[model samples]
Target chain A: MLAIEDLHVWYGSSHVIQGLSLTVPAGGAVALLGRNGAGKTTTLRAIMGLVARRGGRVRLDGRGLESLPPHRIARAGIAYVPESRGIFPSLSVLENLTVAARGTGWSLERVFETFPSLTERRDHGGGALSGGEQQMLAIARALMTNARLLILDEPTEGLAPLVVGEIETLLAGLKETGLGILLVEQNLAFATALADTVHVLGKGRIRWRGDGTELAGVPEITRDWLGV
Target chain B: MLLDPTFLAIQFLNGLQLASLLFLLAVGLSVVFGLMGFINLAHGTLYMIGAYIGLSVARSTGSFWLALVAAPVAVALLGMVFHVVLLRHMQAASPMKQVLVTFGLIFVGLDSVRYIWGNYSHGIDLPAVLAGGVSVLGETYPIYRLFIIGLGLAVLAALHWGLERTRLGALVRAGVDDRETAAALGIDVGLAFFAVFCLGCALAGLAGVVAAPVLSVYPGMDMSVLILTLIVVVIGGPGSLKGAALGALVIGMAQTFGQVLVPALASVMIYAVMAAVLLARPGGLVRARHG
Candidate 1:
């Protein structure tokens, strides 16, 4: 379980993630949906300790996480899949998977089974992989870390419909294993499919929070904040 | 000079000797830059310290082996201390600031070496086993020079294997590719950097110790080699061991071959080759697969 309260982040003179709060319960997938520059990514980064948090109370399973470094926070159990799918380009796909693996919640065998394309391209360079394949590699790498909480930033961005479907299935399957997931997505359909609870972010604050069915019925939040 | 077989052969051997030494230093420089993105202009200073320490140890112990063992270790410890005390603080600073700090250390290192060694050009005598020349291709050559070549090849093989196959190598490559991502993956990036910087410095020092018998151990020696090795690392791709070795060989061959074949242009021929390589590839001969 992960809980974030009154998170504040700033970059030089510009203020991003101003007094935001959210939570992802055990085995719960929380989808953060918003238009561009809505502070969704910043909120995830703040939780990961990648950015300077001016004010925040990020708690993971009752442990305070605001003061720790990114690596320490990760070791405490949170895997991040950034938008760029940060694979070590110089390394082979196998090395990429093995290098990030910590406690081994999912073995390389399971990862290979899940993403057969990764196994086919095991010896190939990480950078040489296609966008969809890279995204698969990124997700596989996150799962490899054995972190209970996964912070995914636009995991389905630029992916084809088929690939998106695969990702949807993958997340749906992963959620069954008691893994907490925080996803920032623009694709409403994909997000709605997996997320039990959804929050619409406007500017730097949570504009709306409800179950998938409730959100689907609220046309005002979808139209005004998400521009959907 | 025009078409002499024996002359070319001798130059070829000399080039190999030079390359052997160049590989040791260039690999360190390339790796340090590749791993941490830290341009340590003072790397050559560590090499000078090695020579100075090796000479002193050899003088007191009367054993080349002891000097060889002690000198590089001392330099490594010194490098670790420097990293902990200073370079660590400058990690996120601008390139100019980092350069200024490292460049300043070059002078400080030079002064320290000078104060200890008394500003004279010193040289090491080859161990008794390698004191004489052996016949190679019917030409007499120093056995110590051959030893240098052999030592360099052995290092190249070990480094190549250790980096490409081992767990440590995976961690290092991971750290180099993306520090934040690597850290997020539970890698101690700071520790990796520290280990790499120390190893790089020690290797540079080892080159100084091993090559001291041939090279004049003087104040400005570090500057000349630093410039050449920097060029070599650039030519080979900044972070690759293969690149460093290839660069060293190319530069060594260019310098030695040019001296014999085109005596007039020998001094500038290496630069010409570097220019040609850069113009063609721009990324160096061995491009790192990552950005």
Candidate 2:
């Protein structure tokens, strides 16, 4: 479970996240939906303490997380998979996994089982892998931390439709394990299918928060706030 | 043939000895440049510090072994001070500024050495134990030269094992590849940078102390070694261990052989080799890749 309250983030003179607030319940899959430049990414970054300048409260499992460094937050059961996927291209697929791998809930074998494509390319350099394979590696890398909360930023971006479907199935499987996921996404239909709760953000603020059942009747919010 | 077998053998040994010193100077440069992405022009100054310290200690105690052990320790401490007081602040500054600052430090370090040791070149006498020459291929070679080569090889092997096989090496590799990600993974980048800078300078110091017997210890030694080490780094590829060794050997051998075969062109041979390598691989032979 995670909570962010009245978060304000700034990049130099420009304010990116202004008074944003949201929460995810224990073992819940939450979708953060937004159009381009809506501060969705900033909110996640702020939670991870990657933002240079931020003011607000971020709590993980009812404990204060705003003051901690990214690694400390990670060690405290939070794993962040950035939008760029931050893979070390020179390192092999297995090296990438081993670099972050701690002996706990997730092991190399477990990751391989979760994403079979990764197991096949274990020795290949991260740079040489395809986009889908790279994304899979990224997710598996996050899983290596065995964090209770996994924050993924656009995990399906630039993937083939079939690959995206496979990823969705993986997420569905993860959900059955009761792993908390905060997925920042643009695909409303795909997100709505798996996310029990949805928060639509616009202009550095949360415009709406509701369950998946309420999403169908909110075309006005979708068009005006999300522009999808 | 102009290359007599005995002369060739001696020259080959000379080349190996020079390569060993070059490795000492460039390995630190490789780590500093690779991990921090900062050009530390004053690294050679740390080498000079080692030479000065060795010269002083050897002069007072009349013990080569004492100087050998004491010089690097003193220089390493100085390096730590330099990192803590100066380089740490300059990390966020522009590369050009960093270059200028470290360049300024070279002059300061050189002047400081001159003030302490005087401008005269000090000769370090090899210990009697290693003073005698050994016959190789019916040609007598200085036992000290072979010692230098052995010491250099040992340092290289130790560094390779320490960096590639240890957890510390993983942290360092990760830090160099991406500081942000390394920090995110819980590594304190500032502390790691400090520790690495000190280690790099310490290695430079070790090189200086080791070479004091063969190479004359004086103020301008830093500039000479600095230029040659820079060439080695450029030729071998920046931030690459294997590249440093290969570059050092190539330059050392070429310089020695050129001096024999074409004495007039020996001075320019290293630059020529570097230019050729750059032409082939602009990024150097080995490069760090991003994920």
Candidate 3:
């Protein structure tokens, strides 16, 4: 249950997220699909309160989140997994999980159960992990927050096909648990498979918003806006 | 041969003693720099404060132990006050501004010490119980110097344990790696920074209190230790405890050996080692992982 209305974000003078609006109902998986430089990531960052300059409203369950600091916004039941997968490289996987684990119901054992690869390499430093392992660790870390809403930016970016399949399965499983997810992705097929709703963004504006079924016949929209 | 058995032993002990003092100063410097990313050029002033407070407490109480325990506590409290009043305001400022502000505080601290303690160098006489020396490898060493070495090792052990084994240490380590991420995890970053700044200042004060007997208390003592501590931090690598210890030991031995074997280079030996280390690693002896 998150609603962002006419959100505007800027980096210095460049307008990033311009008049973008989106809504994710409770227990829904919403995919924000866009090409490179289409402001999908910026929208997620605005929601997390990490953007330098922001305007308009970001409401979570009817409470304004735009004015809150990143930490405060996070504490109010949102977890952000940034595009870069901001893992503390010097920390062990277990240490990363431990640092992010805040409340009950998201213990190390539960996280390990969700991502068993993390349990196997629990003692290894984060930097030493492979891309797939690191992504798992990052997702597991966000899950440890027990966040009501999880914002994932490019969750399957730069991963192998097999690993991408694993991530898809993971997302499908997570969506089944009634945890709301806002996924920023460039992959249409993967997004269609996991997302209940789809929003196509182009030039900092949302061009389309429909059920996943509508994404099938939009060839021109994909070529012009997504270049895929 | 210039290296006789007696001479070598004495040099080794001297190296150990110097290492102990350097460790005390450098670890504090490391924590302050590592956690808050604050370049507190005035940290050495807190060390000077410790010596001054030690002198005043010892003079009044006539007990070396009283000064030892009380001086650092006083300095720690003062450090907390300084963080609240000064550092908190400067947290978001540029590093250059922080440096200038801290440098100004150094001048103020030196002037305050001079105003209170006067210009004369004050020394503490070793307690009579620790005044005597015992035969060590058939060589007599001052009991106080040995005590300094032992105390330094004990402090190092305690610090290592507290930082590496405790939950608080984990929090500090997480904070140092990424302050924003640490905050996101519900850690009170501001409070942690304040506590760490005070702790670092307290260590500097402890160094001052411990070194008061060996080095006389005076105004310029701040500059003297400040320069050397910087060298240690640079050579050891920023924000590394083990690196600081290694840097201190290396510099201490270089200084001690220089004084004995090549007296002219004794003053510049630390700089030479730092230059060599920088030339090799360019990032200091230990490199912190950056995101």
- Report lDDT per candidate: 0.88, 0.83, 0.84
| Runs off by more than 4 Å, candidate 2 | A61-69, A102-104, A107-133, A160-166, A169-178, A225-227, B56-70, B272-281
Badly placed stretches (over 4 Å) of model 3 are B125-129, B178-180, B184-190
Candidate 2 chain B worst ten-residue window by lDDT: B181-190
Give one digit per residue, the lDDT tens place, for model 2 in B1-291.
676888888999999999999998998887678667778999899998998888889989999899888888888799888877988788889999999999999999988888888989888988897999999888889999999999989988987886666656656666666666655544566666667667777788889988888888989899988998988888777777887888889888887788888889888877888888899988777664322
Give the candidates in order of lDDT, highest first. Answer: 1, 3, 2
Q: A1-228, model 1: which lDDT tens digit per residue?
A: 899998898988788877888889999999999999998888887888888645879999999999988889998999999888898987899999998687855999999998999999999998899989999999899889999998899999999999999989989989998899999999999999999999999898899999889998999999999997
Where is model 1 more than 4 Å wrong at Cα?
A52-54, A113-121, A128-130
Best-performing candidate as measured by DockQ:
1
Q: How much is the lDDT of residue B265 in candidate 2? A: 88
- Candidate 1 residue pairs in clash (backbone atoms < 3 Å): none
* Model 2 deviation from native, Cα RMSD in Å: 3.2
- For model 3, state the Cα shift of residue B63 in Å: 4.1
Q: Measured by C-alpha RMSD in angstroms, how accurate is candidate 3?
A: 2.3
Interface RMSD of each: 1.4, 2.3, 2.3
Query: Residue pairs in steric clash, candidate 2?
Result: A87-B291, A89-B290, A89-B291
Question: Between 2 and 3, whose TM-score is larger?
Answer: 3
Error of 3 at A16 (Å): 1.6
